[model samples]
Target: MEDTNHKQSKFQRVLDFIERFGNKLPHPFLIFVYLAAIIIIISAIVASFDISVTHPGTGEEVVAKSLLSGEGLLFALETMLENFTGFAPLGLVLTMMLGIGVAQGVGLFDTAIKLTIEKAPRAVITYAIAFVAVMGNIASDAAAVIVPPLAAMVFYSLGRHPVAGIAAGFAGAVGGFTANLLIAGTDALLAGITTEAARAIDQDMLITPIDNYFFMATSVFLIVLLVGLVTEKVIEPRLGKYDPKYAEEGILAQKQEKVGRIEIKALRNSMIAALVYIGVILALIWPETSVLRGEGGVLVPSPFLSNIVPIIFVFFIVVSVTYGISAKTIKKSGDIPVFMASAVKDMAPYIVLVFAIAQFIAYFNWTNLSTIIAVNSADYLQSVNFVGLPLIIIFILVMGMLNQFITSGSAQWALMAPVFVPMFMLLDFHPAFTQLAYRIGDSSTALLTPLNPYLIMVLGFMKRYDKRSGLGSIISTMIPYTIALMVGWILLMIVWFLLDLPIGPGINIRLDG
Candidate 1:
């Protein structure tokens, strides 16, 4: 029996090792979409199973709900179709990526990286690396698109392990993406759901992107510290000894576009235009009679203040116009539509995927089965009357463990929220606080998982520098960061909970009334 167990462990290790290598050979997005398809099928099957649990609210035992039933499947299809037609982030992403794509296509991103490498103080590399990782999300592709290769080049240039550089950059990009300081797809989705939950208690919960700014801004530093320590102290050291062969080959990373004279002019114009736009916006919002506010005053409750969405629209428009004019993409105003059209074209596939995803999410919720199970599960726990803080900690750990399987934070939140939000609410915890907890849990595991499509891409890049690199290599490298991050991050949440700090504006872990 002992021999058999040992052999099984050895075989498992070999399989993981192979999977790591296999991962390097596949494209990140391809693997993501592929696995997404698998997850969809598996989740659908999981949903289809007639597993049962008692209802939390009523303490009544119940059977698992069936999506196969009439009305269930119909509801699913209808919801998914709706997602395809309206409210998909596809359009927003398309528009944003156009500006980003053009910027990259024109060579500014590479220039930006070169500037960082040239000027960034060596003492601050960790934060600089992490900061670039954070801001890269502005393009949403810069991290995967730019960071790894750039890191490899920088490391090789500086006489450090190129794999360490790639690993750190890869981790920062994907992992940091999970938490953004402002409006993003995750924020939008979470906010929409938050509005839903808040309405249950108070019809008006105008939670905005900056709703949790206070905590999140602070979280940025905490994460940077955590990532920096893990990367510098652990990841880099373990990766040791720069491969001189890599140096001999002189395999420096490539830049797509050079910020030549044309791009420089475009960049200048764009910056100037962005500032001008901000000045006008600030002038309007800063004063009482500027007419940017609501009905109470010229600057009060007015459409200008409420029109944040259009501002988001105008921001892209203004920047795109400036960049295009300077770069000669737009000779006249008429050229603007062409750029916009191109942007929209890129989003069509993402739109399809989202449409499918949204349907799965909405359909699962409508069935009431997920909520029922969550409630019952919470009830069972409550019946035992376990320690509150411990239970929360345990929940966080469970969320971390599950993150290895489910990589999409928003999708996972969509499913988990409908369950935990209501269940935690019953336990006197506010939905926002619970949502925040879910974010931390989801993020810490993202870097270490094979299921993360981006991780596969990162692995592939790692192997480029070291042919022997594979899945086990990626996981082994990332595990230290993951373990370190999990410990510190969970502790931060614990302190926050104990201190009774507001998770966000008017949002608490426990509800009053």
Candidate 2:
């Protein structure tokens, strides 16, 4: 009965999460705010009894962090606001978003997707769609905007049910988003949070966002193969082709714009430019004389790795700009401002949302919630001697399920890191292992959550091809691969833990002092 109740309670939480967010869960920033408010109200009530933790750091310290105090409350709010605004992801995200607008403004991007459909053959379309989805992040929500529509086009043109096309794209795009091998902005953001959490126990510990890049990059191929197999062997055969035989199920389709003369010219130039862009990167890394390579390797703290996101942005921007000019889609330099303005306008709501979140995080910190929880929890775990590889897997499962309701990777990490890092540190475990667990969880469950705003949008795209789909349809399809990834990932981590290999040159699970 207790087990049943436990499952039911979890289910109830999922429902509440859905109800509160409805179609849109509170933004990560705003979620931080609301959580802070809850903590404040509860702390206020708890403080009436004079309840307080003895400051665990210094034995003589008896510091009080009550949300009930007028000054205390204000300080908390201010701190959270500051932290949110200062979060590095904010700037990186905005810059990327702005850069993405250039590609969108030109008919260049839309043309590219349609052109992809014409390029790849039907049998390989499934894998191609998935691969493209992984590449789409360079364009900021381009997966949401382009993949679905492109999937429909691919399916229709090739005489397959467009719904299958839609699902193929949606699953590949989102399910694969978290697991990409290259250290993109998402890796940097999560890595920064992981580093923050890890440092709580050992001040000098460090972790790169792409610490597990080689392993993760390989996972991409497994995902593509699994998703493609499921799509081709199961989904396509079930849905049938897009011709007259499946006539009742209208695979509603549309025609793409022509390859106009100017676009044709632009296409030739852009393709050449794209090839050149890739060639230059190869040249840099291949011979020691080029820019990307540093003393040891290009993939290390090398300039190329650090600045890859910008390079990606520049590549897209230059190619798109060249296409725009050559194709006559962009007439003058003034059009650049117009594109930037439009993109920023779209981002206004997200910025406001993050602002609200920032305030809440500030409040919680001011109340000593984060630090206290982190310290005490770490102490408790140390006393119990419960930190190790096995514990990491357990938490991964918990965080993975939790991710269904709380979709933002950083938000979830921020909440858990303070508590987990300290505790794990006590057990002679480094924070990086725990963070790896978090990443695995955060990623595997991204595909299952209805709470993620993108989830529904992807589904709607599927509906354009198949009206009978739901969250279950998508989840069921990807379940096999999800299980594979979870199991395979944990197994690999266990080996690493046993080897006692250092996380990085100077980083370790426990502090030497």
Candidate 3:
């Protein structure tokens, strides 16, 4: 027992050190503020030194345009509002959430979750929770906030370690972040950045928002299996039997309620409505002369791929409203606007973060620093005879480390895409492949990061089961998932690469092929 306690203590000390370092960093919004200021200062210094690079596609000389200059300062002043409002992630995330908000506001998601949890077989409950948690990303903010606590309740009712359920939910939701059956705002956000970066290398290059859809859809199954195994075989067993002593506090101690008829009806109606909506979409895209397909029946560069977020928005709002009406949750038409407004209101923090991030990205592009770094990095890799698999492993590791300090997917990709995407393209890698590697890395460390906002909620769920649970406890439970996911996902990517499988329709690992 003493040896066991000592090993646990040592593991805890590592988490403590990680949390301490992470706490020293500013809020993500402020981090962007600091980054923007630093970029401007560095750009001025570099401009003074006359550093420049030749554009890879255009063959035009590019030089840093210091924000300290009068014209540069004026441009910043004039474009500040535009930067915030025109930011790609800002509008896309908001648009999708507006629809999702209606579904959540009307008790649609709550009913659906209850039905799923209660009806799942005892042996498969862990997989069910993990799978639902991963799919919940389609609803944006609601999933991260709603799933963990509910998962704890379900586990406690089943006489299992509730904390293990919380960990499972978190592992699938945040750690399996990029793996989803449906494309969400983050997909569109990252693809937009990838497109911008690829254009810098090849003027006519275009990347679809769902460029990684095939790979990610397959990943959802893997996340469910792997995370479910970890929860049942590793975490739950380690936790042993749950004590009633610990259960007498927080949410777990509250009275449990059965799923009502109204909720069941709501869920049933929602499913029917969702299928009809999907059928409509399929009917529109099935024919060779369908308007949804681009020229020559191509999927990529098609209107359907480009308009995915809006399509998701329409689906969520319409079906959720139908469910609300059937469930008697919505009595008046005015309720629809209220729910939509609630969703937008919930995104206040993201708006501020996007504002700062937009300024940083615009300034980075103006200064040409990212291009210069991409050229230099590509040159160094070439000199070392590095390309293909070894380079991919390095990119994944670098991104995994960075995820610890920067938890926002869009923000991290905003910083990385400008340099790494083009650099990989120079190595004959397609931008889709580069984005795929980055996504795998960014997701792998999400469960272990103190910087992740969702981890705070996960810790809260843990405390409901064990009042003294801390950041260290949560991190310790999650580190195994983080490591396992990185290795497993990377190996998957390697096999996919070796097999020369297309990551998406008309997209491959190599640009020229």
The whole-model lDDT of each prediction reads 0.62, 0.65, 0.82
Tens-digit lDDT track for model 3 on 1-513?
A: 999999989977766777778889788788878988998899999999999988776789988778899978997999999877876667777787788889889988777766777789998999999888888876665567777777888888888888988888888888777878877767777776787677667757767667898888888888888899889888988888887676534565664467898778778888898999999999999897888899999766688877777888899887889988988888999999999898888888877777888888778777788788888888888999988899899899999998877778887887788778888887889998899999999988888877677888778778777887888788889988887888889988999989988887778888887
Point to the candidate with the largest lDDT: 3
Ranking by TM-score: 3, 1, 2
Q: What's model 3's TM-score?
A: 0.92
Off by over 4 Å in 2: 1-30, 41-84, 107-112, 156-161, 181-185, 191-212, 237-316, 363-368, 382-385, 421-436, 461-513
- lDDT by residue (139-215, candidate 2, tens digit) is 55676567866777766777777777777777667766666643455665566566655554455655555554654
lDDT of 1 by residue, 173-247 (tens): 776665655444455456555544433223454444434445655666777777778878888877787665543
The CA lDDT at 110 in model 2 is 63
Count clashing residue pairs per candidate.
15, 14, 0
Candidate 1 overall lDDT versus native: 0.62
Q: In model 3, what are the clashing residue pairs, if there are any?
A: none
Write the number of the candidate with greater lDDT, choosing between 2 and 3: 3
Q: Where is model 3 poorest over a 10-residue stretch in terms of lDDT?
A: 247-256
What RMSD, rounded to one decimal, does every model reach?
A: 6.3, 5.9, 2.5
